[model samples]
Target: MSEPLLLEARGVGKSFPGVRALQDMHIELRRGEVLALVGENGAGKSTLMKLLSGIYTPDEGEFFLDGEPLRATGPRHALELGISIIHQEFNLMPDLTVAQNIFIGREPRTGRVFLGERALEAKAAELIDRLHLPLDPKERVGELTVAKQQMVEIAKALSYEPRVLIMDEPTAALNDAEVRVLHDLIRRFRTPDTGVIYISHRMDELKAITDRITVIRDGRYVDTLDTEGTTMPEVISRMVGREIAAGLGPEGVREDREVVLSVRGLTTKDLLRDVSFELREGEILGFAGLMGAGRTEVARALVGADPVESGTVELRGQPVRITTPAEAAKHRIGYLSEDRKHLGLLLEQDVNANIGLSSIRERFQQWGFVRDRAMRARSREIVDTLRIRTPSVDQTAKFLSGGNQQKVVIGKWLVKDCDILIFDEPTRGIDVGAKEEIYRLLNELAAQGKSIIMISSELPEVLRMSHRVVVMSEGRVTGQLDAAEATQESVMHLATLRPETEAVS
Candidate 1:
């Protein structure tokens, strides 16, 4: 009977206040197959994952594993059953070593209480070696790179000898090379007795790694297809329930403009080194590179979030010193960070409050009283402008969908009226619909004479939005190409160029 499949979820449903987050969601995972669950933000992808991982009990239906009824009250119970989940957010203790994190609870006890570090390291090393990971079990997990930390998470999952593994956007934070490494790991983990449920927004990765595609839409199961037979557009149509229009905005056509931002001989300790670039008004400049190629650091340094020990930032024609973010703002420079939850939004605040945060001080009266009416009007304008889908302006930013929260972040910068905006991974966790909206907004802003520096790890987004592309590698600009001249191959070549190999004038 085909072993009754590894796992079967039947008619799962869930709801939140005034929202049916998931409904009649049916999915199955067989041993030796990678089942990819795909949908846009607010399509109930996370809710379904939560249900599968035992973070939430289904309001209606039940799941079966190996033909036996399974009811897990919580994630711990599910983990004990050999169903492991790797969350989008890394859950790790900074002070703990790699071995400690992997064997967090079930540590080897030497006596009745003390941890057996040597034994834990031995076991962790075995798992790491099995994954062909270069991680040192003795090293502190906090000291490792994001990619390495992710590998450790995978090793920890393997330690449980998981029969089914659930991964949520596993490659969102990884670089191109790291993504390649992870793809290989996924293949190795696929066995006749194991299954993997992969969740990701990157369409290309879905085509590359997944075997079966199950698309969900608006909390409902749409359909499933064989990955080899289906196309990206078809999957997108299923998830969105409509023909997704080609990405927003006019393709990069304004290459003949004067420079708006010019950075020469830029250098920061460890973060940036001799980086230089020129950005033109009404043009979207894309910065592309692998993680640790200094993309975030460059954005932070450009917006004065980090101080530069050397280099000059010129606005229009004159040189300027951007010692702080405020100074950068004064120069009409704005930055949207990649770390949205921590650095981008005030989660506890309402959408209106966060939208007006950067300009709240400016909008206040003589006794430092906030002009509530004025702020609300401004927030409303931006909300409508961005087409942010929220219940109301009073809704907490945290309650909004990932894509809407991202719009709130953009609205904050728009309120600041900064002409030069630096967006670091603008569509990082956003859905396809929201991504198009953001792209359109960016295009409109540029058309209105705002210069933009967009730092993206996604090559397609970079290609689609930028007027010119600047490839950064190892803290330096390796090459710059006009949109017409840039291809994935050419851009990647420059993005992966080694710092030591850079030619000097």
Candidate 2:
């Protein structure tokens, strides 16, 4: 006989003003199995997770645990009742140590009043060691790398020892090695009485770690399939309600094209060294490397978000001095950051306000007054063009899904009419359908004579979207390859080449 259902949601529905976020959503998680839940952005995936985690109560329907009706009052209550959720956006306290963040409210104490730092760290250390995660319990979360911070989040979730664990885009920021470690942990977490609900946009990972797949679209349940019996394209088709076209390879740029941006010997005090590259007009330049390979650093240093100790930047054969982001913007350059929540979008603001931020003074100000009407009109146009799923332009950005939030960031830069655009991990947490849309948009922008620098960790994304690829390693440019020459093997070979090793070769 099959294992009993560990968790089940029956006809669950939720709604907010101006948005029917979810309706008649159903999911089942069997004991000792990892269940994959997938849908396009704004397809009610997040809403369902929130309801299951007790962040939101369903307006209708009910949930059950072990065949018992379950009703949780809040997140804490859910945790107490054997449910823990790790959200895509972190809930960590930057200034606190990993140990403190892991056991914030339930820390061991002396005399029931004084905090016991040593005991807390010891507990965290034991948990980390148990999970085989490479993390220092005493290290400040703010000082850790993004991948390490992700590990801390995992540690915190697993510390709850809940019967049901919900992880949202847990591997979005992780590298291959880190991802392997996570998969191992998930395998170890599986037990006869516990189960996992793994939400992700990555199909390959779903195949590797999940037993069954559940597809939801537009806030409703579609179907569920055994992972091994179904294909990715089939799953995607159901998720988007259409057949997505096959991947399109990048077309090479002409050598005669004008060079729009030139960086020669770009060096930063921290991690970049003598990085040199030229971006041609109407070209999509891809930067690819492993974690800490300085791809992001290059983008940051180029846009003056980070100081360059030694380097020269030239625009159209004319040298330019850019020491701040405002100066970069003045030069008609825009950067879409990888950390959208922290760096790209103003979450508290509405969609219209966030989309018009970059071009506010130029396009929305008249006689020292803000032109709110014109701003909303422009935002509406971009929203429709980008197919951003929101109730209206007046909707708060924080209410939108991760992919839609990313689109808003893109719209802000588009409204600015920047000649040169830098997109860092533009589809980091976005679904496959949204990724295809962004790819098409990038190609269209390049066809419109705009130069783009795309930094991505996904090799397939880089190979598919870049006219030329720049490989980085150990804070230096290891190799540059044209579209025809860039392959996964070639890029990985260059990305792993250390400066000293390259020099010796």
Report the number of the highest-TM-score candidate. Answer: 1
Task: For model 2, state the Cα shift of residue 270 in Å.
Answer: 11
lDDT of 1: 0.83
Q: Name the 10 consecutive residues with the lowest summed lDDT in model 2.
A: 496-505
- Every candidate's lDDT: 0.83, 0.88
Tens digit of per-residue lDDT, candidate 1, span 393-413: 899989998899999999999
Candidate 1 clash total? 0
How close is every model to the real structure, measured as TM-score?
0.64, 0.61
Per-residue lDDT tens digits for candidate 2, residues 1-505, read 7645899999998889767888888999999999999876578888888888888999999999998998998999999999999998899999999999999889887677845788899999999999999999999999999889899989999999999999998886676788899999999999998999999866677888999999998899999999999987677667656532233457688989999999999999868888899999999999987666799999898888999999899999999989888899989999999999999988999999999998989989999999999999999999999999999999999999888999999999999999999999999978889898899899999999999999998777888899998988768888988877766656655765555445211
Q: How many clashing residue pairs appear in each of the predictions shown?
A: 0, 0
| Poorly placed runs, candidate 2 (over 4 Å) | 1-4, 109-115, 244-314, 317-321, 329-505
Alpha-carbon deviation at 381 in model 1, angstroms: 14
Candidate 2 Cα lDDT to native: 0.88
TM-score of 1: 0.64
